[model samples]
Target: MEFTEYGFPPDYLDEISSAVQKNDIRDLIEEGLIKAKPIKGTSRARARKADAQRAKGRRKGQGSRREAPTRGTPRSTAG
Candidate 1:
């Protein structure tokens, strides 16, 4: 099968074909032809968990208070 059939980048086709013809299994392994074990969870699940944790840490009213601007300076505002 052509490398493009396996969804590999077209530029890597020559190297991939050479490796296969040379019996260089390392490249195949790196390309995930051989599975070691199934991942426990989907990447989407992991990403969601990470995003939730980050959102929790960014909860409103969590950080040090800024000093109120003195009368002369313009107060900075959020959009």
Candidate 2:
């Protein structure tokens, strides 16, 4: 309904949606909506790219590095 990336249906959605309960993800999963499989993430590729970029003098700024220490951190809640 909101039509975000995860919310909106993809290209092959019609075939799957035709069978499952309309607009309901739970029902679709419960009824086994065309055997959807989880795909592996590209985090490794992204890490490699970041490494390459950093090697080329990118993402080495103050924003990239940790500006503060965990031990010397500020406490949000007073105990």
RMSD of 1: 12.3
- Kindly list the per-residue Cα lDDT of model 1 for residues 1-79, writing each as its tens digit: 3334445556655655677543575756677543355446756887787679768874333253355435335567422
TM-score of each: 0.25, 0.31
RMSD of 2: 12.3
Instruction: Indicate the residue-level lDDT of 49 in model 1.
Output: 78
Best candidate, lDDT-wise? Answer: 2
Report model 2's TM-score to 2 decimal places.
0.31
Instruction: Summing lDDT over every window of 10 consecutive residues in candidate 2, give the lowest-scoring window.
Output: 1-10
Q: Model 2, range 5-58, lDDT digits (tens) per residue?
A: 444346547855565455566676665543454576666888898889999999
Backbone clashes in model 2, listed as residue pairs: none
Q: Candidate 1: where is the Cα deviation over 4 Å?
A: 1-3, 21-23, 31-79
